[model samples]
Target: MNTRDAKEILLLYRGTTDDSDPQFCAALDYAKSDPELGQWLREQTKCYDTIRTKLRGIEPPLGLSEKIVRSRPIPFPRIWSRVLQLAAAIVISASVTVLLMKWSERRNHSVAGAQEILVTGEVLDMTCYIAYNLSGPDHAECARVCIRNGLPVGIKAQDGKVYLLSGEPGHSVNAELADYAAKTVTIKGRQSVRDGFAQLQVEEIRKL
Candidate 1:
C-alpha cells in the first residue's frame, strides 16, 4: 500500500471496532501473507499491546477516593458570595483594560504603516497557505500584502515568506495552529490570481 493508504488504514485500525469484521480480517490476512507487511503489523500490535498494558496498570492516587467521598457540601453564600463579587469587578476591569489596549494598539499600528486584516477559513490539514497578491511586484508591496492579509498583530514577512509570530513567551505558532498550519511561516511557492484573490502555494509540511 502507499504511505497515505497505510496511514489511513492505521488510523482506522486505531479508531474502529471492526477488527473482527470480514474486510478487516481479509486485510490482516493479506498483510500477514507478505513478510514486510507481517513485520510491520507485528510491530504495531506490540506497540498497541504495550500501551494498553501500561494504561491498564494506572490507578488513582491512594486516598483520592476517600477524599472525594468525604468532601463537605459548601454553603452557597460561604462558597461564592464574596468571591463572586470580587471576581465580577476584576473581570469587568480587566476586560475594559484589554479593550482599551487593543484599540490603542490597533490605532498605533495603523499609523505606523502597518495594516491588519482577518483570514478566516477552516484549515483542512496541518499544511496550508495564507495566499496574497504579489502582482504589485515590489518587496514593500509584498510586505503590505502580508500586512493586509493578517500580519500586523503578529505575522511578518521574511525572505518573501509570511510568518505568524508567537504571541508571547516563545517563537512558535500558537497551539491553535499546531494541528493546522504546520509551520509559523509558509514560503510562497507557485502563485496565481483568480476571482480577485491571489492563491499562493505553501510547501514543506511534515510532522517534526
Candidate 2:
C-alpha cells in the first residue's frame, strides 16, 4: 500500500487487533523503513497514549459516582452533602488536568526544522481544503478567510501530498500567505512532524 493509504489505515489502528493483517503489516513494515513515516507513527502513538491517559485519569474515583446515586435510608444531611461537593471537585480537577495535558501537548509540539526540500502546490487553508476537498484559484478567497480566522494553512502538492505550514507557539503562516492562498507556489522548507502532524518551516516561497 502507498504511504497515504497506510497512514489512513494506521490512524484507526487498535493495539488489541492482530498485527498480522497483511495491509497493516505492510504499513507497519514500511513505517519501520521510512524515516518520515516512522516518525509519524511514533508521534501518532504518543498522541494516542496521551489520549488514553487522559481518559483513564477521568475515570471517577472509585465508588464516587455510585455513591452519589445509591439509595440511602435518609436524605443526605450536610455531612453527607459534602460527599456530593467532593465529587464535584473531583470532576472539576479532572477537567483541569485534561486541559493542562492538552496545553502541554501543544507546547511540546513546537515545530522544528528537518532536511530542506522543495515542493510545489497550491497554498490552502487546511481545514477548509479537507472539508471541501478543494484546491486552486477558485478557493483562494475562502482559504484566506479560514486562515485569517486561525485555521492552519498548508500546501497540497501536485502529487496529492499536503504539507501543513505551522511553527513556533503562535503559528508559522505570516501576512505574506494572504497573497498566496489557494494559489500555486513552489516553496522550499525544512519539514518536520510532531504528534503525527506535519509542517513545513518555510525558508523560500514563490509563485509557480
Candidate 3:
C-alpha cells in the first residue's frame, strides 16, 4: 500500500479507523512488498507492545482471580438464573428509585401549590382600582379584573366606592393618591400598604 493507505491500515488496526475486511487483507499483501509499509507496521506493533507492558505492570484488584476460581462452578442453568436475577434486581431498583423521585417531586409541588397565598382584603385593595360591587370576593374574580385591565392585584372593595390602593407600607394614602394623579408612578419597586383609609400608592409594578 502507499503511505496514505498504509497509515489508514495501521489506524484501523489501532481502532482509530473502522474495520474493513478488504482493506485489512490488501494492507497485509502490500506490507509484504513495501519496505516503508513494513516499517510503519513494525512501529505500530512496538507501540502495542509498549502499551501491553504498561498494562501488565498494573496490579489487578486484590484476590479477584482467586475469588473467581474459588467460587462454585457456575453451570449454564445456574449462570443464566443468576444473570436474570441480577438484571431483575437492577431493573426493579431503578424503577423504584424513579417512582420515589417522581412521587417526592409531586408531593413537594402539591405542598407548594397549597401554601401559595391568594391576595385578599387590604392586600388586594392597594394594587388596583376596584369598581365591582361583588359580594363573594375571591381570588378568581380579582385575577380576572386585574388581567383584563393590565392592573396589579392590589385593590379590592369589601363595600362602598373603589379605592386606589398600593402595597407601600407605612406610607400615607393621600401621598400615593397625589403621586397617582401626577402619573409619576414607578413600574418597579418594593413598598408596603398598612391598612385601609391610609392611601398607599404604588409608583410602579414590574414582573418578578
Best by lDDT: 2
Q: What TM-score does candidate 2 get on C-alpha atoms?
A: 0.45
Clashes of 1: 1
Q: What is candidate 3's lDDT per residue for 1-208, written digit by digit as tens?
A: 4866664445335322323466576776677787866665655544334333443466769987557656964455656865685455435433432443233223211111122122223323122122222222333333333222222223332343332343333333332332122121223222232223322244443222
Encode model 1's per-residue lDDT on 71-158: one tens digit a residue. Answer: 9544564447546754554354334324432432333111122233333332211111221221222223223322222222222233
Clash number for candidate 3:
23
Looking at candidate 3, what is the lDDT of residue 138?
34
* lDDT of candidate model 3 versus the reference: 0.38
Kindly list the per-residue Cα lDDT of model 2 for residues 153-183, writing each as its tens digit. Answer: 7888889888877544554454667678878
Q: lDDT of each prediction vs. the true structure? A: 0.35, 0.61, 0.38
Which model, 1 or 2, shows the larger TM-score? Answer: 2
| Deviation from native of the Cα of residue 82 in model 1, angstroms | 39
Which one wins by TM-score: 2 or 3?
A: 2
Off by over 4 Å in 1: 1-7, 11-18, 63-208
How high is each candidate's TM-score?
0.28, 0.45, 0.26
Give the Å error, residue 62, model 1: 3.2
Which residue pairs clash in candidate 2? none
RMSD of 1: 18.9
Candidate RMSDs in order? 18.9, 17.9, 28.8
